[model samples]
Target: MSMWSFILLLISVQCVFGTSSDADETLSVMEDDSVTLHADVSAIKREDQILWRFGPENSRIAEIYKQNMPTYDINERFVDRLEMSIQTGSLTIKNIGIQHSGLYKVTIISNGGTSEKRFRVIVCARLPIPNITRDSSQCSSSSYCSLLCSVVNVSAVTLSWYKGNSLLSSISVSDLSISLSLPLEVEYQENNIYSCVINNPITNQTTHLNITQLCQPCADTTRCGSAEAVIRLVVSVVVGVATVAVLVDHFRSVSDTSPLVP
Candidate 1:
């Protein structure tokens, strides 16, 4: 093989062995939020410059130059979402979304030579509050009660049910969805506790459920007695009113017959 081709082959072998000469950092940001990627160019001089690229294919995203004529140019892919600092050569993304998440590579020109800094960006959407509702149709007072955990506007989120620290059931969804749900059933008891949790890497929400509150039986005997007493009182009042009406009708009929004789 030619010298240049042999050199290229050696570089490929090193990459396959996970020894690529690129320096990279990992960054995680929440969706619709802003994050700053530090370049550590504190010693950057007026003669130095910086070039920022994104994605696996290294698409041009932004450029900062302090050479003969200082200027900043951001590509159309980022549009109004990118900002560059002249002093530190740091870049910030504003209101980032999923499409803006990926590998970001920057090439910096210094007195030593051209070096690179890579950032693996992860963008997560904030999780919504999960609804922990009792499934009334499936619950039984003598046994267990079923509860459903659900959320809307979910992306890259996991919904789970936990009894203390032990996980009972979980569902992970990476794609965006209008609704996601998971169900769990547990025996009814006064001290039983269950929690429904939904989370991403950055944020989470949890709601608790208690079996006693959700799976209670019908009205107790105490309330039943009061209900029966009210029914009896209403019946007695109706019968008394009927008896008075009958006596009034009989008196009127007798008076009508005697009036003709008088």
Candidate 2:
């Protein structure tokens, strides 16, 4: 064979051998607050080595392993947070933020050949806590109070209004701010509590809102009388103490001057 044909044959043989061991190996990732990647190469050749790379395009190397040995070279953003176990072929990343979402590549190499697999890592955003506030003046006997539901830290969300355990209404929008006005259809008394729930599908996060009825003027005559009495008693005690002090001083002065005559 010519020299070029000989080289081509060698390359084709290597490619075939490289993919032969990949049939039994598998890789998967589970994500929560962090990411856990499990790679099983136990069925592959015993002398094979594993390498891990991570990035948007999988152009950077995050870690490497060979024969139960490991060489970690992670980016600056994942210095102390990224970890790998060579024996298990597992990678655990802590505090997985939005920036960490991307593609990851794992390469297995042996003296005979090499094979590669790719996994996608997805990092979710934390959901915002919903704030519910009511406007009392806007509410009348004909109209129920207006409750505002606001969320921070997220731009898009779905807001749901719940009365007790039942869902009242749901509104979805790209903006973070939303409000729902309750209608005075029934005998809605003061101190009624409502809830607003926000959901973010991307991050799989849900938050709740607690809404309370607006404050009203108290109309209990007995309680108001008792409060007034207490205030009067306090003022009387203060005045009585001042008067006694003045009388005692006057008496002391008179007694001190009249004592010589006695």
Candidate 3:
């Protein structure tokens, strides 16, 4: 074979087999957003054939041939969500969802040879704001307040507690959608800033804690002084009313027993 012919044969062999594993690109996108699997070619030639396969099954999902219009699989799995760029052979998935997260491969075939590209897509759910609540079971203590930071129906995320810029505690889940909670203990009068955060690879949400507001009822402290003051005020009013009633009754009895007034 001639030198040019040998080069063409080698290129064709690589394309037929597929791209190298290290060439696989990883993309992360939030649910309901669009993701484009780039062909990485400068342009698509008129006689080139573009094909795309998806998932571990390598199911053919889209194709374009010889300057003809692109077509997508009629499978309900894709429906109207797939689009292709005729000029570049890149594929775009609109309003992507968690079910669509998987491997994707694109092959471009031409008279000279062929080229291939692979991609791994990760679709993540929106992160919910972490909640910070006082752990009531630990409320009996006066020196410190027990708190919990939590989130529900989350996957591939980490829940964390931070004191100012410092991390206090964290818990993570990889694939399962479940609830997560991290506990923290702080003095009732803690002046340092505290916050709870929940995050995935793409995004994060945080909630700040107000120590005085959440731990205000802890026992034997000024944090409980307002409630105690109210109780004391009520008792004093009741005793004063009883004393006035007794004095009025005693004066009434004396008047009834003494000389009559004009």
Best-fitting candidate, scored by lDDT: 3
lDDT of each: 0.72, 0.55, 0.81
Q: What is the lDDT of residue 203 in candidate 2?
A: 32
Per-residue lDDT of candidate 2, residues 1-262 (tens digit): 7754453343333222322232333222223376767665654345767778776455545445345556667467667777776566667778765455556677777786777776655443455666655554455434344556556544335667776678777766543223432322223354444566765444333334332334232245677789999999999999999999999999999988884544
Model 2 CA RMSD to the hidden true structure, in angstroms: 15.4
Residue-level lDDT tens digits of model 1 in 18-101 = 223344776667779998988878856876878888866777777777643324445665778888886777889998876676
Q: Candidate 1: list runs displaced more than 4 Å.
A: 1-23, 67-77, 175-178, 210-213, 218-262
Q: How big is the positional error of residue 21 in model 2, measured in Å on the Cα after superposition?
A: 25
Highest TM-score against the true fold, candidate: 3
Q: Write one digit per residue (lDDT tens) for candidate 3, span 1-262.
A: 6754453343333322333353478777888999999898678888899999997688999999987889999878788999999888899999987677668999989987987888967677788888889898877746788999989887667788999999988987753457898999998786999999987667789999999889875565565788889999999999999999999999999989998679
1 versus 3: better lDDT goes to: 3
Ranking by TM-score: 3, 1, 2
Residue 77 lDDT in candidate 3: 76
Candidate with more favorable, higher TM-score: 1 or 2? 1
* Candidate 3, residue 109: lDDT: 96
Candidate 3 weakest lDDT stretch, 10 residues: 10-19
What TM-score does candidate 2 get on C-alpha atoms? 0.56
